[model samples]
Target: MSNSARVESPLEHADFAGLAALKINGGVILREAKLLGHLNLRGNANDPDFLKGVKSALDLDLPLAPCSSAQNANTTIMWLSPDEWLVIVDGVTEAAIEGKLRQSLRGHFAVSDISGAQTMLEISGKDCLQLLQKSIGYDLHLDSFPINKVIGTALAKSSAHIRRTGEYNFQLIIRRSFADYIWLWLQQSSKEYGLSVTL
Candidate 1:
């Protein structure tokens, strides 16, 4: 592929940029973190060398605790399982980051560039929790689901890896094939509180 080739997000047809221009104030705000790189990493969590290599490659410690996440200015790493993680970074940086991991790490480690397989959506505003409540069965209480926590669960009959970023903010990593369905679900579910789209 040429450098000049156009890159399109899974929700490219949704035209979120156009909707963002309307500037409608709603209780729920949504934004697509379009074309960000998604990488699925698998390795031994018990191995100190693996952890050290990951930290060296990404500049952030791998979140080893269950349903936890770690983030810095450049990347966010979510623990998917005892031995699996999902790393999100700027779209242009995945290749370089993956290369660093491959070069620095050794022994039974795997890194797959799954960027094209998923997309991320940021949901916030006062009614964001309510919107989420209508979709997922997971307890949304902060006490139960603290900030910087990640959970893979069913959302509106589909599935997503949901991460709480703040009191009223969440980041969802969803499958590309389900993007349109989730988009429509959000539209209908947030109709009562109103929905605002941001670029």
Candidate 2:
């Protein structure tokens, strides 16, 4: 079968439908950012050619600052290391984007599709910060983790690429194998605030 034909979200078996039916309005809102394209790219951050090629390919810059990201309407590039970045796009466009990058780049660079190995979770709402504080060691203060910032941090014994997308909202890129564990962790952490699931 084609990859797309066999594609399945890590949480496909989870009962999100039941969770969504809960009448209680939760202070913590969770949603799976499933089936998105994830590309692990390693290139020279100091190379103007590399940066320009990526910009030309994705219309977004490679964030040079530590723990920062650059996002456009359809893509986000998260800084993973001085020489590495994670590029996320709509699932259908991943192959095309990677192709463009490969064709446009020169010298030393590497791009690997990692969509099958990772998934994203959108976490937000009034009590989201408190829930995060309970789950992660990173400081969630606005002064420390402002919008558009990304951090590789520990979350309930698993590691996630956490990005602050808004004041109370975050996008977590987590390993597929650990999806259930993280889901359970979130459920437990947000119990006091109630749990709301969105598709």
Candidate 3:
């Protein structure tokens, strides 16, 4: 393997860095959480050992309830299903974390690195709620979708795992193949409120 080989983010061609310089008072802010590690974890939710192994490895408890998520300083665990979770961690740590999980866990478990298959985009600012309301059918009201809740839903023509990170902020986990399309859709949708980019 050559050291010169570089890993490019899925939205590399969108030139987010260039847009970051623009001084726009946009109601919606878009920031790509680029190059983060995405690990799909599966195990028996009923097994105490499985739960203990995960806690030992990540130092964070799994979110067992449907559409729930838990996060610490280094990792965010989202409950994807009864027996599966999506774990997001800092960039370049997927292999090490996976290794820890493999070492700690025993019997009937699976962990796969899916970092390259997708990307995360954070949408926030004043108009973020309105933007999301137009994009997905899910209710954005705090009563319905409170903070730290994750749901897999349709976003425009594509799909994403939408997570509420704050009162007016959301993180969208979108597929790499639809990065360009979603970027374009965001630009158009936020035209009235304005759109600003951050590196």
- What are the per-residue Cα lDDT tens digits for candidate 2 across 99-186? 9999989999999999999999999999999999998999899999999999999898899999999999999999999999998899
Pick out the ten consecutive residues of candidate 1 with the lowest summed lDDT.
1-10
lDDT of 3 at 124: 98
Candidate 3, residue 108: CA error in Å? Answer: 0.6
Local error of candidate 2 at residue 120 (angstroms): 0.3
RMSD to the true structure for each prediction, in A, is 1.5, 1.8, 1.3
**Which residue pairs clash within candidate 3?**
none
Expressed as tens digits, the lDDT of each residue in 22-49 for candidate 3 is 8688999999999999999999999999
Alpha-carbon local distance difference test for all models: 0.96, 0.93, 0.95
Candidate ranking (lDDT, best to worst): 1, 3, 2
lDDT of 3 at 166: 98
- True-structure Cα RMSD, model 3: 1.3
Residue 116 error for model 2, in Å? 0.6
Q: What is the TM-score of each candidate against the true structure?
A: 0.97, 0.95, 0.97
Over 4 Å off in model 2, which ranges?
Answer: 1-4
